[model samples]
Target: MIAFLKGRLVEKTPTDIIIECNGVGYQVHISLHSYSLIKDSESILVYTYLQIKEDAHTLYGFVEKLERELFKLLISVSGIGGNTARNMLSYVTPKDLMQAIASNDIKTIQSIKGIGLKTAQRVVIDLQEKVQKMYGLEDLSTSVYNTNAEEALSALEVLGFVRKATEKVVKKIVDQQPDATVEQIIKLALKSL
Candidate 1:
């Protein structure tokens, strides 16, 4: 349960990095995306997940919580090992992965080196609702829509509608109109609520 390592990076590679925290060097496995982001920095705070097995203990690190969350979700799917999950994170961005799973684009997920057709399909089926719940995605095409949608959701929550139900309605409205303003979204959400 090593939540994170915040220290100087002593060694780095595409696959892993050694971070020195409080005079101790800890080797942590990482995805390519994390490597690229931390390669140029002197110090880093790597979010970590420690996996314990009968034979060995391993630590996987990510530069962002989004990446780490995706890693955990990927590993939770049937037939996806830690290595396979890491490989998937290395091969695809978290945003793209969520989009692919939500849109049921099995081909995009299967494009990863080790992910096969069945695993990809299973990932979509198992994670699609989880992803949607975690992200409350409507139209991921722009950050603006997401922000407005979230603001409207908060407003709806303040208005006493259950957060989950309001989120569902607001996300549906957002999906139908990506350019909806916060007020417009709240108004439309009120009607739906």
Candidate 2:
């Protein structure tokens, strides 16, 4: 396996890039996230996955090791091909993807282009446990009602507060008071946010 490539970037586009290492130019397919990360750099080290098929060998590159791991996990699903996995990574950040899988959020997975209902369900059913175990995510099925925090975060977002920032405040409030109602959570988060 070509674990990574450290080279000068010769050409780049939203979907792919060519990197020159030791006078050899290697064409690598990339997701938009990786492209955005490496776009401004002349030199870079990209973690890569080399996919070997009967007909062709393809190289997919990632800017982060986490992204590469996610790509490998996605492609492991029966119906998910490299292109579909790439599209998924392009459509959502690795963190969001992991959360979606961990939470059994099939709708979020299905929202990606080219992913259908059955495929999304399969992705969730097949990877949910793995993702939860690997990432140490709480199983939402048995976990406490997190709707309060979610609702508070949504309300804050509608009020022009950033979701990421609001999430922290709402989470703190919810942790302090798990039985807090959505209204109460929102009110408390409003003060902190």
Candidate 3:
């Protein structure tokens, strides 16, 4: 199996990249998270997972081993194919995904495009125990959001506020007052909206 590739990045896009190694260019699929991490680098080493089928051989590349590992675990769930797993990764960072699963936050999972309530529930039910065991409670502390900001964001989203807009306003408020509580953030965001 081709475990990894090290070469010049000949082409790059949000969904894929072409890595040229030893005069051969390999097309590698990637999630948005990987793209963001690797976009500025001219040369990179990407750990890969090769999926072989009768008709095609596909390679999915990751900037971090942890992301590849998460991808593997995501695809292992019933009804989640590689593309669907990639979509999920594109929607959220691996740390956030781990937190969502560990906390049984189905709303976060369901928010991703193409994911329904059943799939989100299945993802939590199937992977929550395993993710908590592997990553543990300590690892979740350093996630994408402060607990207050995250809770406020969730509440704002439920109230029909768009996430991008809500985030911008909430971030401004939090930046001005770093220690803002969830209620404070939500109250300020509501006014801004």
The ten-residue window of minimal lDDT in model 1 covers: 137-146
Q: What is the model-wide C-alpha lDDT for candidate 1?
A: 0.87
In the order shown, what is each candidate's alpha-carbon RMSD? 9.1, 8.0, 7.5
Model 1 over residues 1-193: C-alpha lDDT tens digits? Answer: 9999999988899999999999999999999888888855778899999999999999999999999998899899988888999999889988889988876778889999988899999999899888877887543434766699889988888878899788768767876898999999999988877
Put down candidate 2 lDDT per residue, 1-193, tens digits, no spaces.
9999999998999999999999999999999988878856789899999999999999999999999998999999998989999999999999889988987778889999999999999999889888888877765432444566666677788999988788667666765787889899888877776
Stretches of candidate 2 off by over 4 Å are 141-193
- Per-residue lDDT over 1-193 for candidate 3, one digit per residue giving the tens place of the 0 to 100 score: 8889999999999999999999999999999999999966788899999988788999999999889988989998999988999999999999889878986778899999999999999998889878878876432233334677789999999999889888778767775776778898899889989
Give Cα-based local distance difference scores for all models: 0.87, 0.86, 0.87
Over the full model, what C-alpha lDDT does candidate 3 score relative to the true structure?
A: 0.87
Q: Give residue 54's error in model 1 in angstroms.
A: 0.4
**Pairs of residues at least 3 apart in sequence or in different chains that clash in candidate 3:** none
Q: TM-score: which candidate is best?
A: 2
lDDT of 2 at 84: 94
| Candidates by TM-score, descending order | 2, 1, 3
